[model samples]
Target: MSDRAETSERTTMAPRASELGDFLRARRAALRPEDVGLTPYGERRRVPGLRREELCLLAGVSVTHYTRLEQGRGTRVSREVLTAIARALRLDEDEISHLMDLAAPARRPAQPRPEHAGDSARQLINAMAQVPALILDRRNDVLAWNGLGHALLGGHLDPGDPDLPAHRPNLTRMLFLEEHMRDLYGEHWPEEATLAVASLRLTAGRNPDDRRLAELVGRLAVQSGEFAERWARHPVRTCTSGTKRMDHPVVGRLELAFETLQIPKSPGQRLIAYSAAPGSPSERALRDLLPQGRPDAEERPRAVLSAVASRG
Candidate 1:
């Protein structure tokens, strides 16, 4: 199969409002009447969670209004209404933001604009000899990576692949489609995969018309049953920093704390850098993976030039 896999036949080119409805339904189904202090009578409930009537009662909206919203009808969806519904559902801050994104009017579909790591970003990653760092677009495409970053995360792939748009390594695809990534996470694979899906859902809400992203999501959904199931749950969240446990082939078991630094000029581009705690086994393992000496700008891969060129 080609790298840009065709979207599954079952996947529809549905409107964003449809997504909003799906999210609401999923969240509503997951919420119990008892969650919001609504006493359930001693009887078998016909459906899971709170019924529409109960939810609307709690949200302070008429059943008709709530039903219309859940049905994705063309009624004016006000922020106040969403806030009320969000409160009724007990959504967290990230979920609240995701709800707003899904409810926003869809933008006109456009061609996928090329994304690349700028020279400054490349230089920044290269300078971090001890830290494993890589630049990623909103779609989780690896635009560029320092030697240590490539060695630590994707030693199985071609080192120069990230420089070419067509061949660039996407972290999301690797997590689900590639066995090496799954092996790296080992016991923590489920947590890692869930977080990846949740992060992608957040991005999808923000850029509903991003065709490439849609393609990525559809391909994963069709190819990986695990991904399809989690996606159906409508998980949404923002993850800026976290700890990753990995069973590296060369460095053995390592626990690394990671941080994401957003590039202001490139809206969705961010530099993800990983570091181990001081005087720890992970630090020593990380140091073993680093190159003998800091690589100067001249030593950086030629792939970066191709990436920079592709941006224009």
Candidate 2:
């Protein structure tokens, strides 16, 4: 089978309602009336979480207005209103950004595609030498990867295919669809997968009109019941740096620190680098494997040109 495999049909579902409403509804359901210091006189509640009236009151908005907003009636909304609701919901910086994105007056425009991983970014990854690095677009599609990255995450697949958009390896997709990726996380698979979904939720909210992104979502939702269930939860989070626990079949267990660096030249692209702490056992293991991967490709550190041009 070819690497970077995709479903043959590549189906897309009918677009759901403005995600603004869905987001509000989901978040609202995740809290309880008492959680926000409200009492219902011990009366049985009809719905989960706080009632719409309760939330509106807490958000300092009228019942009718809040109801309308949740019903997808906003052609435009004030930042003040959004801020108020975000405060009432106790949203974090990442969640607040997602809220604002969902509640924006209108989507600016669809991103035709994200920028390529330029030469500088590729060289940066190469220069890191010991670091396993991969550049990914906003949609979580791998744009470029150094040899260590390819070996660390996807040794069984073709490393070059991700440089080409038509067959790019979407990290989230691989986590769910490819058995190898799921196994790599071992005991941490659930946490890793949840983070991926949550991060994607924030990205989707921010770029609702990106057609390719929407297609990816629809495809994942259709193919993986696990993905569909998680996506419906509407989890949101922003993560720049984190630690990962991975079990490589060849390298054994690895505890690595990862940093996600945004590419300034490519608005929607980010270069993620992974390394174990210096002098640590994980670092030694990484060193042992760094030279083990296939680095036979002549263009080892070449830039990832735009997806259209890079494809075979």
Candidate 3:
């Protein structure tokens, strides 16, 4: 906790740059001449990948214009230009989305008060009795969660982290900072970590006016080198549905599929649910954690008897 004192002192803000430059630079370096159908002819290359001139030529933009873009000098880049560049760079959907995000102009609107989960949202999560469900806000703060969610994901952590805005648990923060949480992904930790950071990048771009989020980024960058490195990658992805490989200490290994449902009425909130296929061993293990028919003798802290979805 004392470590946060260092980051809390500065007024460093987010959108530190459209990150357009960093993303462009990294992507450019990742590509090779042969990969792009360009002949290098063993010219004793001094640069990492394609030169700024080469990429500009391939992207069909003037070298000067593309150089300015890579230097973070362009305040506003045209969509047509971005599209051409994306095509030239062979960017996938996610990478293209990220490129757009990084090139987006900055906004400094008034920061609104921390929004809490509505009564309906709270009730909705509780209603998902057998499934582990959680409500997250724009900043990836855990606003509310069902009992199963608490047992399934947060058994070793404090339940109150979802309640108070000041004490709320940021999903990206925990993925890197907490050991137990990091272990949840087991062998697939790299994918999980990358997706978590990329999804967070998307969220951060959309909520640039949120001061607490800005501070969260600063804090993470200062406290965890892993988070800092991932943040710099400028990865972008919308992780709506995915399969998770989790190893719970009690239930052994569980492979579950998860989905994210956006709340229409809520502008920046989503309900995430995790479940295993019916009749599978994973499903049976998950069911064992729920309390529909489980006896008291078999119940423990991991057994969620009812939805105590109250925020601490």
Candidate 4:
């Protein structure tokens, strides 16, 4: 597929008010009155969980106002009001951001897509070859990766076609939908899922109009019940640095530290590098699994150029 076509298919679309309302209602419905310290009365209520009035009471907002907000009638919600709702709903930082995003969307005509890495960013990734490094766009599309970078993560996929949405191996989708991902990560699926959802939640809040991102969220919501459930809870988080244990097919059980460096030129793009302490079993495993020769010089230059170009 052409670059634009691939991008359009993979990126999330903007969220509509109705979509936002339904999401809110679903989440609200999942909570019981007692969850928020509200008394349950009128047991014959038609709804399965807390009623709008009960939610409002717990949230310390008027029933009518909360209802209007849930019904997509209320606009211009104050930050304090949003925080109250978040607390009542037992939302995390991620979910709170989502609520705010739904309440106040970014003005149409998104800020210009940031410039991709310049030569400097390329050098950075290249210099860290021993450390598995890859660059990803705002929507989490894999923009570029060094050879070792490819082997460490998605060596099975066509790295050249990383930009194509269909071919794009979204970290979340792979975690839940791809059998290889389950096999590769073994029991770390839950941790991976939480991080992915949290990251997506953060992105949604920052760039709600991103059509491709919206589509991704919608697709995952439909395909994976677990994803849908967590997404509705509106959890948000940023994954900058973390420790991950991976059961690699070739490298065996490997525990590594990872750091995400945001490319200065690319507003939403980040370069992630994975490392293991020297002489550790995981580090030795990685070295043994990776090719022994000096890294291919030809592809290095192209990878650097691609990383920079993707920002544009």
Candidate 5:
């Protein structure tokens, strides 16, 4: 594709300051005056939440300065100023980190690099034979998945799909665009959908230079109105661990607690493993999903599956 055409399709190609401004505006609009301990004097309010002037006063910044920052004209923002604004906005740690990223995104290579699960990461997931585990990139592209992971989350897909760079199943895409995945979450789909979008929002802010990630957002926004709506809300969060309620086609309903462990030295790459509480029905169902002849519980498997191979 031509450079201009490609750039046009990328959602992150917009100026960083503009994104920062939009995020600030959204967060500012969501907060009411009383929420921040400011008694409303009621001067015929027009805006939803704290006005730019009110926020500037609360943040200890001048109206013109805050206005410049909000209007995408402020290129150089200090950490102190950002911290002050974050406090006034009542932003949590994740949101503060997001603000910092928007103000000063880490420089990345202009080229998009191929993402692959390392040999050790694959070995680690396979070692946890009893657990359902998958390795995903910042964009939530499934780089690799153990057999149980495939069985639990994507039995309908080809087991080797993750090995293909061009065809890697993106979790966020499947959540909104794929029917089988939507069916897996059942009635709790909306909650899962929201969390997925919120998590993606953080990734989008942190990796503004990622063209593929930008294209993913653009495609989802165009194809899924629900995704577009949530994206517009600008939800930002870090879900390192959580419980997922799912209705598996094979195992039925399961309340599985999942943990996301970041791979050392690999930014945005993490291993997500899911398990149920001991003696619970969910645990029993999980056990049933394990591969047959998995060496006795006390013993490790003789070898890992070929599906977990590293890139050549």
Candidate 6:
């Protein structure tokens, strides 16, 4: 609640309009004239890529309108115009979705916070105790994590506290800025960085009005040059299932397969469970560490889930 007071004083911050413009422009420039079926002009152009008129012709928008949009002068672009621009630039679904978010109108006002997790969510986490399980909000906050979860992923934090975001141990920030994280994961930082940036990109597409999420990303970009580089590449990926390698101080090397399960009716919350193959050293180590076939359960207050209609 005290944290809420601090957060409330800094609410309603809007995303940077120039940043959005730069993003759109960069994506447009990446497309070659030949790739889009346009003939290369005879002379070298001053700009690195496509001219504004060329993109407008490809996207079927007026030169003035497209120029205005790219310059961040237009604020009321319709979905039709956005779709046209996306098609002209040959954007995939994810890129198109990001474009839509960039073009969306600003949110009106703050609404009540949504329910973070329910009894069912808690039960699911309890059931997966033998497996490292964590519940995260869209911004990658550690909302609720079981004992094995904390032990396996981040041993520095307490699993019993839901307000851990105050310490700001975001997975993205840890992977990039924290030396402990680099030592813990070592060679796997690239994989982890890709997934973290990809997840953040997906969340941005889904919740453009989430000011806290925006702030967290801005901070990460400023603090970590690696993150800024990866983000600039415009790499997008979905994290549904993957294999993660970790060097746990207590358990040594672990090759664990992870599955991300979306919480039913919880739009942005996901339960990530990690498990090693049976009879493997990692699995055996996990079982040996767990006592008498009992899994550890730590209870804490859930996150504040906003009441936005589910867009999933």
Candidate 4 stretches greater than 4 Å from native: 1-15, 41-49, 109-117, 162-169, 218-235, 294-312
Alpha carbon lDDT at 268, candidate 4? 79
Clashes of each: 0, 0, 0, 15, 0, 2
lDDT per residue, candidate 6, 190-234, as tens digits? Answer: 878887897787677567667677667767666676776666665
TM-score-wise, the better of 1 and 5 is 1
- Tell me, by TM-score, which candidate is best: 1
lDDT of 4 by residue, 93-176 (tens): 667767777778446645533333345666777677677887788877776666677777787876554544446556777777
**Comparing 3 and 4 by lDDT, which wins?**
3
CA lDDT, every prediction?
A: 0.85, 0.79, 0.75, 0.71, 0.84, 0.70
> In model 3, which regions exceed 4 Å deviation?
1-18, 291-312
Per-residue lDDT for 168-263 in model 3, tens only? 777778888888777877888888988888887777666667677777778887877776777776677888998989888667788989999888
Clashes of 6: 2
Candidate 1 TM-score, true structure as reference: 0.93
Model 5 stretches astray by more than 4 angstroms: 1-10, 105-109, 292-312
What is the per-residue lDDT of model 2 for residues 1-312, given as tens digits with 9 covering 90 to 100? Answer: 211122213223322334777788888998987788888667788888889888889889878888877887756678998899988887889999998887765554455844567778877776776788999999888887877888789788777777656667889999989889888998899998889989988888777778888778877877787787778788999988999999998898999999998898889899999989879999988987785545553274343343355563
Steric clash pairs (candidate 6): 114-305, 114-306
Cα lDDT tens digits, model 5, 27-58, are: 99999999998999958888889999889889
The residue-level lDDT of candidate 2 at 69 comes to: 79
- Please give the lDDT score for candidate 1: 0.85
User: TM-scores for all candidates?
Assistant: 0.93, 0.89, 0.85, 0.78, 0.89, 0.80
